[model samples]
Target: MSRSKFFLVVLICSFVWAFVPGYLFQSLTSISWVCWVFSKSVTAQQLGSGMKGLGLGAFTLDWTAVSSFLFSPLISPLFATVNVFVGYVLFIYVVMPTAYWGMNLYNAKTFPIFSSHLFASNGSPYKIADIVNQQFRLDTEAYDKLGRINLSIFFAISYGFNFATIAATITHVGFFYGKEIYHRFRASQQEEPDVHTKLMRKYEDIPAWWFYSVTALSMIVSLILCTVLKDQVQLPWWGFLFACAMAFTFTLPVSIISATTNQTPGLNVITEYVMGLIMPGYPIANVCFKVYGYISMSQAISFLADFKLGHYMKIPPKSMFIVQFVGTVVAGTVNLIVGWWLLGSVENICQDQLLPPNSPWTCPNDRVFFDASVIWGLVGPNRIFGSNGNYIALNWFFLFGAAGPVIVYILHRIFPTHKWILLINIPVLTGATALMPPATTVNFNSWLLYGIIFNFFVFRYRKKWWQRYNYILSAGLDAGAAFMGVLLYFTLTMENRTINWWGTGGEHCPLASCPTAKGVDLGPDSVCPVF
Candidate 1:
C-alpha cells in the first residue's frame, strides 16, 4: 500500500504500537470498561464482557484481536467494509441482545449470554462421552435419560447466520456478477488474443492434461479411502462424491467473492449441517466431508489468488503451477508432522477444566472444533436444527438470505443512478459475524475502529500517505505481533512462566461464562439466583 520513502518509519511505528498489547499490557486485548466500573455485578459483566459475553459497547487495543479473523481492513474495499459494519451492528447490538434478553430465545437466559459450549437441560456441561457408544454413534438410551443438548443463544443463532451466509453468497453472486462473468467468458472464447495474452502465450505453458491427470489420481485415492477404508473414514463412497460435488459447485461463486472482496465465505458450517442432516450419527464422516468440501474450495480460491498475482507480475503459468504444487506438498507434510508432535508432547492439551489458569495449551480454537463435531456428528442436526431440534424455525434464514440480494437488485434497478445502492453486498454483509465463536466481539470492535480510521478517514483526507503506507503498516504490525507470539512461546510458554499482575491477568470478567438462569448450581460457590 506504500512506497520506500516512509517504509522504515511505518514499520518502526507499527512494531512499537503492536508491542504494547502484544506483551506488556495483556488485558488491553479486551477492555470492557463497563465491567470494571461495575466490577462486582454479574449482570454487568455478562452484558459487557468482550471475550465471553455480549460485549456491549466494548473495545480492544489488541491488533491480533482485530486482524486475526477479519484480515487487514486496509486491504478490503470501503464499500464491503461498510456493509460488514452495518451487518455487525444489526446482528450484535440489535438481534443478538433481543434474542437473548427480550425474547429469551431458546431459553437463552438459562446459559451464558455468549459461549460455544454445549449444555444439559439443567445447565450442566453436556457430557459428549456419556452419550456416545463404542461405535461413535449417539447412544439413544443415554440421550433420552440425559435429555436434549442445548447451546448458548449466540452459538445457536450464529449457526442460523451461517446458513444465511452461504445461501446469500450464492444468490448475491448470481444477481450482481452473473452477467458480467458470462459476457467475459463469452468474449474470452470468441475474441482474438490481446497483446499481453499473446506475450504470455509465448512462455512455456503447463499442459491441461497434467492438471487432469493429477485431479484424476487424487479422486481415485479419495474414492478408495471412502470405499475400501469406510471403516476408518466412516463417510460412505457416495458421500465422498457428494462432498466433492458440493465443493465443485461452490468453488466458482465463492472464488468470485474472494477474488473481488478479499473475503471468502466459510463453507464448513453449511457442509457440516447438510452431512449431519443426511448422514447422522457419524462424527468422523461429518468432519471428513467438511474437510473435503470446505477445504477444497478454500484451496481453490487460494490458488486463484496466486494465479491473479502471477498474471499481474507476468510470471509464467508453468513456473507458478510448479512452485505452488511443491509449496502445497511441503506445507501439508510439515503441518501434519508439527500437529502430530504437539498432540503427543503437550500435557492435558485442550483440557481446560484440568489445566491451570492462564495455561497456554488451553485451545479455544479446538474447543470450537469439538463443539462442531458434537453438534453435526455426534448428536446430529435432527436433534439440533431439524423437526426435533429447537432451532427448526431458524431454517427460514436460508430463504431470508436468498431474498436479501433480490431486494438489493431491485433497489439497484430502480435507483440506477444511486451507485451506492449496487454496493450493498448481501453476502459480505451477512457473513460479517461468521467467525464469532472463535473470534470474539472485541475483534470486530477493534477491527472496525481501525478500519474507519485508516480506510475511511486516512483514505479521504490523507490519500497519498494512505496509498503509500496503509498496507505496509498492516504487514509490519502482523509480522511484529507474530514474532512476539513465537518469542513468548519459547521464553514463557516453554517453562510455564507467567507474570501474575493485574494488567497481565486477562479481562476481569469471570461471570461472563457463567449461566444466569435461576437455580442452576455451578459447584459450591457459583449459583444463579432468581433475579
Candidate 2:
C-alpha cells in the first residue's frame, strides 16, 4: 500500500479504538464495578489483605518492560531496571516502613505508607480551596492557622529526590558522555551514517524546514491559545513563549542522553522549578507552564522517536507525521472525554473525606500535581528549601546529586580496572523513588520481585531462551492483559453486570488509600488508638 493509504488505515483504526470505549463508558457514570463488588454495609478494614493486592500489582508490570524496551532496545534497559529495583527495594521495604512504623516520622503510624493526599499539622486532610483567596492565591493567614502541610517522609524524600535526579542527570551526562556532548556542540561536524541512515538514503528525506515550519506554527497557535484561555490555564503569553523556548532548548540534550542510556530524564521537575522561580505565587499558571514546557517537549520527542523508527524502516516521513498527528488527536480526545466522565462520576476525587469507602480512584497523580503546584507554585522553592523552612535539609540533595556522579567519575579515573563506579547512577536511583504515591508498596514489591526473577534470574540462567522470547513474552502478556481488560469491560456492558469482589473494589487494601492520622474506628466496634 502507498504510505498515504497505510497512514489513513492506521489513523482510522486508532480513532475507532479510542472512540468506541470512550463513547460507551461516558454514559456509564454512576454504574461502576467497585460499587457492585463491595457491599455498602461492609466494615472498612485497616491496613489491607495481602494476596489480593499482589494480583493487581503484578498485572501492571507489562507496561514497564514495554516502555523500557521502547526507550532503547536489547540490554540497555537492564542496568536502569536493576538500579530501579534496588531503589524500590530500599525505599519500600527498608526506608518507608522504618520511617513510618519505627521512627513514627510525620506521625506516619496513624496514616498509610504511601499517599499523595496533603495533611495538616493536626493529622487532618488539608482542604486547598479553603486556604485559597478569591484571586486563587494562597491565603497566608488561613495556611498558618491550619498549619504547614504535613508530608510522609516517603513523599518528602520523593520530592527531594526529584531535585537530586535533575542535578544527577546533568553531572552524569557530563561525566559519562563528555566527549559525545562536545562533538554534538561542534560546528561543521559530519554526520556518521549508520546502517539505517545508509538504507534510508535511497528514500527522499524529509526537509528540516518542514519540521521547523510545523513547530513554529504550533508554537504560535499555543501562544494564541494560552492568551485566549489565560484565566482557564492561568499562563501568560510571555510564560507560554518562555516555556516553548525551554522545551526546544532541552529536547536535543535530553533525547541524546535517552538514546544512549535507555533512561529518559523528564523536564517536568526542571520546568516546574524554573516556573516557580520566574512566575511564583500563581499555582495554576505554574502547572500550566509545566504542561506546556514539559509535555510539549515530550510530545515532540515522541514524534521524533516515531520519525526515527520510520527512517530505520525506510518509511516515508510525511506518512509517519500524519499517523502520529491523527493518533495523538484521537488519543487526547478520548482521554479528555474519559477524564471528564470520571470527574463527573467519581465522587470526592482527591478529597479523602467525601470519597467512597475504600475507593481506589484517589487521584494520586492529581494529588501529587496539585501538591507540587502548592510547593513550587504557591509557596515557591525558597520556603521549602530555604533556611527557614521545615524541609531545608532537602536542599542539600541537589549538591548530593551533583557530587555523586563526579565522585563516581573520579573513582573510575583512580581505579581504571574497576567497573563498579560506572554502576552507581544517582538519577536512576532517585527516579525509582518517584511514583510512590500512585504506586503502592505492593506494586513496587511485585515489580521488583518480577524483575529479579525474570530479568536477573531467568535472563541470566536461560540466555538463549531469554534472547529469543524475552520481548515476545512481554508483548504476549501485555496483549493478553489488555485484551482481557477490554473484553471484561465490554462483557459487563453487554450483561449489565459488575464483578462483586473485595479484590476488584479496592477494599483488599483499605489502608492503602488512607492519608490522615485522625482516630477512626477500624470496624463496627474497634477504636484504633493513635500511635
The lDDT per prediction is: 0.84, 0.62
Q: Assess candidate 1 and give its TM-score to the true structure.
A: 0.95
User: Largest TM-score belongs to which candidate?
Assistant: 1
Off by over 4 Å in 1: 1-9, 12-19, 192-199, 525-531
Best of the candidates, lDDT: 1
- TM agreement with the true structure for every prediction: 0.95, 0.79
Candidate 1: tens digits of C-alpha lDDT, residues 302-414: 89889878877789999999999899999999999988999999889887867776566778878888889889998899888888878898899999999999999999899
**For residues 53-164, could you state the per-residue lDDT of candidate 2 as single tens digits?**
1122222222322232222123345676777767666665576557665777756644444456666655556667777888887787887776666665667767777777
Deviation in Å, model 1, residue 515 alpha carbon: 2.2
